[model samples]
Target: MTAAALLLWRDFVRDPARRLWTEDSGCGEWGCCGSPLEARAFLEGVLRGMSRRRSRELRAVVDALDDAY
Candidate 1:
């Protein structure tokens, strides 16, 4: 993903209001996350599904985020 997109993900993960989705809640194209843990899982899944070159580029940042939580 682009740096700005990653930054947005990070911000979303850090936001305390990012909670479980409700029937009325509008989820985005990327889906919804109830917590940082779930968001990290989603990120890891994305990484695993991407090409090695792309995954490698973002692995460090993802790992760091994992460590933070």
Candidate 2:
């Protein structure tokens, strides 16, 4: 629920497989806040069975955080 988290979630929605997983896929561009490794790990979990409500919640939290920042 932070600006960084929001940015990451936004980027994730834009590209589902951008992060892929925790491993280095030789292509790192998923990190919206500028942390490919973390982004990749986040994607690994979110990509599998991700829910709309969860996404919305994350987005809302991110938005609030972003505003704070």
Best by TM-score: 1
TM-score of model number 2: 0.28
Which stretch of 10 consecutive residues in model 2 shows the poorest summed lDDT?
28-37
> 1-69 in candidate 2: lDDT tens per residue?
234544664554456575464455445554323454464445445534457766676556545533443
How far off is residue 19 in model 1, in Å? Answer: 15
Q: Put down candidate 1 lDDT per residue, 1-69, tens digits, no spaces.
A: 344445655875565665653334444334342333445566778888989997886898877765654
Q: What is the lDDT of residue 47 in candidate 1?
A: 86
Judge candidate 1 against the unseen true structure and give its global Cα lDDT, from 0 to 1: 0.60
Query: What's each prediction's TM-score?
Result: 0.49, 0.28
Give the clash count for each candidate: 0, 0
Candidates' C-alpha lDDT: 0.60, 0.50
- The candidate that wins on lDDT is 1
